[model samples]
Target: MLPTFAADDYIELAADLPATLQAAIERDLGIDPAQYLANAEAARAASDVATALRAQGVDILGTSIDGQDVTYNVADEADAALAEAAGAEVTVGPIELLDSGREVQPAQDHKGGYGYAYQVAEADETGSFPLSRCSVGFSGFDADGNDRYLTAGHCGVDEETGEQFTYPVHHIELSEPIWATEDWANEFPGPELGEFVPGSMHFGEQHDGGLVDITNPDWTGVPQVAGWAGGSGAPDENSVTIRGPIDAVTGAQACKSGATSGWTCGEILVPAQSTPVGAQDVTGFIFNACLLGGDSGGSVVVGNYALGVNSGSTHDGRTECDSWVPATGPDDTTGDFSIGYSLSTGEYNALTLLGSEWELSVAINTPQVTSPEDGGQTGPTPTFTGTVEAARSTHRVEVTVDGEQSYEGTIADDGTFSVAATEALAPGEHTYEVVATYGNHSRSEVASGTFTSTEVQAEALTVESPTNGQTTDNPRPSFTGTGQPGATVTLAVGDEVLGEATVAEDGTWTIAPSADLPVGERFDATVTQAFEGDSQVVTVSDLGITAAPVTITAPEDGSTVAGDVVFSGTAFAGATIGLAIEGVVTESSERVQTAADEWEGELVVGEDGSWTFTPAEELRDGEYTLTATATLDGGDPELTSSEASVSFTVGAEGDDDGGELPDTGSSNVWMIVVGVGLLVAGGVAIAIRARRGGSTA
Candidate 1:
């Protein structure tokens, strides 16, 4: 709960504290001890009249106390005695006196007035009429949404025209009486009479109070030449007074009010008094602000809040006064300028009774944390913050994070509170709950929100196969590697999920289906790996499979071959195999399987030597035997037979028929001889023809 001002502290102590400290307290707690004391004192002084007027209804004009109105004078011995008797140092002023007509203009005689100074408007344009000096003032709103200026009851006439109102005089350098003529006065100092605003219905003509609505709808212009020029000094709480049980009696410790000169503090001068209503005695308090003519309708407040309006003052024990002259005459001005009357609680009750009033009440929805998604790899943290307003004092709040209670707090006297979560949350869906607390009266509805913590990591899973574009039935096939683990791994293309695998505990993981892997179709897989508070992610690739298991064939080994020597083999579709002579491949001896399990191609071999055929689809002639391979489904490979070699012999030039052909390790020597004889015969024929031609030439 907010702390209230003490009943005794004063302005001296409040001003003594460091400005920074005082400002900090005011910012945080909204009150100062000394300021509260001053307000209480002011209220005590005002209450003397308040109590009496609340009981009765009019101001007793003849009862003057120290130059203040007798019905509501703070310095009056009777009022002070009554206060002390009632167990308070001062009386709280119920300063809500509605003025009949009066605008809050600039103070006129600051030196001679009480809290402020003001000038009263005269009726005649000749400037020969009597004008009262004003001091007290108050601020309020009128029916037309205009600022209503208030002041003393005796400031002027037009009780028939409307409330005794005044106008805002901004400038302080010009003439004495501003807006003297009716035409000029009608522009500002005048107001509509039919509304009868600023007049308390129940306290008509009781407290000698009056009110006037500032005519301009928008009055942002600077003050007139005769106005107070915006006086300094905000209200000081330490100057007020307190009396009565504030909650029970409709009487608070202190009320606040403002005037043409500045803001001021006062107390209810009386509890209950019998005073005059238009020459008839009614009851009310007399505040101690030492006011004059213009202060008529100035506002009175308590604890930084508005309370009442300033009204009439009386001739009392003040200096320089001979007799009790009428308040309008100059003789009464010399006595004292520090007294005024205000409406009593009864008057305000009667006016406000059964009327539609707007109370201060508002509520804001609880905030929700935004960010990290549950089980997500990348996002923000879980958190939320904001405020709510409750009109009553019994409100409390409950806060939860991730579906768990995190904090609980109570609303202060001003109806404000806050809550925070306890610990950092993980990535994933989280829900918060805020429930209002109360007793039998009924609790407020609960509000909730959902949010996520940081996001999780994403890892990709991939697999590579042997053949580029082939499928086979090979078992125990070889694979290149596995993809990153913890990622959702599927072996398929598009929307299809072929074979699936979760990344193993280690970085590498493999998925081998129990059944034969699908042939022809493509597969893709994905996985999520949470890390770094689930904030980082990575994706890898999965390659399509190539199949294997090929068959290859070649000539005998350790023999030379020439011409276009053809080699054939069966390999997985899109599989390539090489044919080599001896340990080196023949020039252009590469062959590829155009279709599944079928391959054939020709390679030129030369001289008597071994031609090895190796499994290579595209390569230069080299010294390697031909071997075959096939790719099965899911792109795995199976090896075929070892390299097979081919050999062939070429006869030497001019060799006889009996001379053995260059041995290519032939099993039959005679067969080689025959082959050599045929080659020699062909050479001899060509030579013979050439010799005959030369002889003929």
Candidate 2:
């Protein structure tokens, strides 16, 4: 009989947990301790009901607990009502079980070890090539205590030979050769393996596993699993450590680390399921978590316990239902359902292969730091916190700071511990290392990090006006901010100096640019404050200075014109010239034209940022407007430019002068000559009249 934990025990445990763990349990998992205990009890009751229904010959698919609700999947609606009456939520769906097949070939190349994915390639006598990619299941020892790696059995078998064979297993990182030794296959039975299976399909009878020799000195063997909390494909300093294997349970949240997909999690739908693939029947755990082609043989885990190895995934025709689909496969596929063989079954198979005397286990599960991250900077005094997985074994965790200052603590019931530096040290670079010593005096690998400490007093600095990401047309914008009193504030864009200011007694400072900023330019206003001997810099990025819109004020709208048509507009400094036709084309005979008349012209903006459009020829009798569009190149799209227009009408042919008037449109000189001729004639007529009047007197 197993020991039972009461509700009060859970509440006490929750209350005694560290602040970090409590926050994680509540924020990430969304469940408190009392609620968790109640849900567990409800799940147990639902399981008992399921067992009783099975005894009564009820046709049931499966049962699992989702949150506080105990859910039962059934093939018939009548069975759902029966389950609901028995205090279980019911869902109707097909039993659609699936099995493991050979992993698919890789599409791209990558390199990693342990929980990382790898490719295995082999060529036959006909020069035909067969390739498959799979992840390393776990690192362990065979019955003879020989160091080895485990993976899916189908990864090492050849279809041509229909049997297991030795082949070179390539690691993504190392150039050295790693070989997979054909130790065992689940469906294929060796002469010695028959005794362990006998007639039982639930045990080693349908196991799918293989082993790789890892006695090479170049390879490092650590009891860590990659892709914890959706990590990258490459295993780095943040990989999770495996505590040990645990029994698979339905409705339990499970996650797997694969080479292609990194880490993914879902609930276990069926703990023990017999599924059929192409021509083989595989018995394993079924889950809804995403699995892809290159994810085969990855580790499946629940919390800190290593549970199983990924085999394959199901391909149902409903691709829209799941969050992910295989990178390379058919479309409209709904089934991301995956299957994994339990680690216990793989361990038993290994024992059967090498003899029952050997034991398979993980080595040196170390502690990890959760606060004050590696290569980070902190103040003079710092508190350190981390977690360690020592199972039920007694162990002492020691944290060493700067190789001199040391603090020791014991692992908690939930595998968490914290320690604080006893004294504040002088400002400098500091290092920390955490080590765990077991009851037998065996020490784990050290987890170490380095950080910098400074003694400068902290001060607040903020930009109070024309905030970050603001757009304006003021070229010499004023920047105001608050900083430490008596501090010098220097503002710059990249390496070019904008201006500087000194903080007043009230801790307020302002800076105005010495010269106008370029129109439509975006830049970061890097503000640096220096006080005493310490200085800090803050950057306000994406500040924009927009260009003023072009405005045509020279040619008034709806005015009449006869000749020398001129269009003028004002725009921001350095803006480019742009023109557009704003009206329909009118014949010379037309008396009036609206703004819809066609108008066309182009001109360069003056150095003063003003533009004037002057037609080289005389204007015809018509109405038109020239629309001017000015654009500045440096600002965002929204502040680029604005359109401006002026409309006027060309007077009739004889409205200003007689139809016989000389063509003065050719040149200004011709118009000047015609005006001089009229003046001389008038003067001659006036002289003659005065002479005649003198004769009459």
TM-score per prediction, in order, is 0.31, 0.36
What are the lDDT figures for the candidates, one per model?
Answer: 0.34, 0.54
Writing each residue's lDDT as its tens digit, candidate 2 over 1-697 gives: 1123355656753454333333333543356644444444444445455655656555566665555355556778877777666655667974334333433221111111232222234457895554454676665554555545555555555434545544444444311111222111221211110011111112134565556555445564455666323333234424555555554546665666665555665556666676553334456677766665556667776655566777767533222223443222112134356777766432233234432332334544577988668887665666678887543234568888988888887776456777766666578888999987643334678999987776757477777867888888888889898998877898887778889998998989999988776557677888898764457888887888777788887677767766576667788776765654322223334233222111222344677678776544455444455666667665465676788767776665224322211122323210111111111211110000000001110
Model 2 lDDT on a 0 to 1 scale: 0.54
Question: Cα deviation of 75 in candidate 1 (Å)?
Answer: 27
lDDT of 1 at 370: 29
Reference-based TM-score, model 2: 0.36
lDDT of each residue in 178-280, candidate 1, tens digit only? 2122222223323222211333322343444444333444431110111121122232322222111121012223232323333323333433333443333
Task: Work out how many backbone clashes candidate 1 has.
Answer: 210
TM-score of 1: 0.31
| Span of ten consecutive residues with least summed lDDT in model 1 | 685-694
